[model samples]
Target: LIQTFEKNNDATIRNLEAWSLETGQQVYKINLTGAILFVQINTDNSKMLVATNDQYLRIFNLQTGHEIFKIKNQWSDAQKEVTITPDFKEVISIYKGNNLIVWDLEMGKVKATFTTDNPLACYTVSPDGKTIVAAEIFGKLHFLTLEDKE
Candidate 1:
């Protein structure tokens, strides 16, 4: 199992802890440079993606506890949500509540960007990885199709 450790007073995340479910022992403890805002495990569970207060996205190897890559978030907007694509080749994130960003994992660069007029509250990609459904803060939902063309 995976869990986050935090200080009681400020309730800020301090580190990430992964424990063995079978042995009930601590597996690894990864120190964080900043409070973790988002955490995601890839499909195979070998890699972990974490977004922190430092405005960077970090990918780590779960078994070795070593960093695989890091991507600087260029936008100053707050990251609302993040997810690894079904194929684990890209990262899709929503920033500033309306900006959708797709980052290529291998290149550690932004692959595409899209924006909506209204502030988005949440979003999710279809299982087939060809569409996105985003809901506005005011409850309006928008359905978008994903394409690779630039």
Candidate 2:
């Protein structure tokens, strides 16, 4: 499955669409109130994570075209990137100040926070969602492991 977005003349987001690459048919479409900064589809393709410039992250059900949940950015800065965990149970995001946060979808709260010394250039989560690898602009890389909190 592939997803695409359309923008208006004002450089604002107009809509988000999910398409089937093989059939070339749209599976779902949703209107947006803010410009999208990042997007990620869960490994199972059941849900989608959308991060917008309006300081919000929204998760939607792909099949029903309904919003599952929306998260307001806690920090004042805009989110630089976002990704869904492999298990489809969490949303991970990197903010402007290099703040990495993991949000538990079921709990509707932040599950963990990792501070970085420098601004994060990019980040990737392991397939099992147990580890996160973050890279900085100055050729520095940080590895973080998630442990059960009990």
Candidate 3:
């Protein structure tokens, strides 16, 4: 669950607070240097990932409040549009101005990546978790299959 403290401008006054649904205890607190672009709470509610205008991504342990991972260069677009997999095991972040990266949460590595030919319209993952498709300008689409990953 997410609770926000608002400033006079109606922007978030401070870092957002993450709480447990059952007990309502503070699980994590996330701060942003700039506007937050992407915010995700994992399926099990054990992890939360925050993406921001700072071009940084950080993963925190919901229970212990420890930072488990931090990554940059995962997304490059100042547009700051990112989507997390429903299962919370994968992340799809696109910074179309420079590149695109799809990451594996467990390994914390690039499962696949590609540079854009032109500006990107959008990106999507296959329902089975095996493929990623990105739509680009001029009605072009790129498909990357991960079913054969070793």
Give lDDT per model, in order.
0.79, 0.79, 0.69
TM, every model? 0.78, 0.76, 0.76
**Off by more than 4 A, model 1:** 1-9, 22-24, 74-79, 136-142, 148-150
How many pairs in model 3 have backbone atoms within 3 A of each other, for residues 3 or more apart or on separate chains, i.e. clashes?
1
Q: Which candidate is the best by lDDT?
A: 2
Worst 10 residues of 1 by lDDT: 73-82
Give Cα distance to truth, residue 53, candidate 2, Å.
Answer: 1.3
Kindly list the per-residue Cα lDDT of model 1 for residues 1-150, writing each as its tens digit. 666565545787858888888888888888887778778888788988888877788989987678998988743435646777787777787776678888888899998887888877888988878787888888888887767766
lDDT of 3 by residue, 6-44 (tens): 343656343666677789787666665655665677878
lDDT of 1 at 107: 90
Give the alpha carbon lDDT tens digit for every residue of 1-150 in model 2.
677789899987758988877899998888887788777777677887777877787888876668998988654444456777788777787766678888887777899988888988888999898999989877789899877678
What lDDT, from 0 to 1, does candidate 3 have?
0.69
| Clash-forming residue pairs, model 3 | 77-95
TM-score preference between candidates 1 and 3, better one: 1
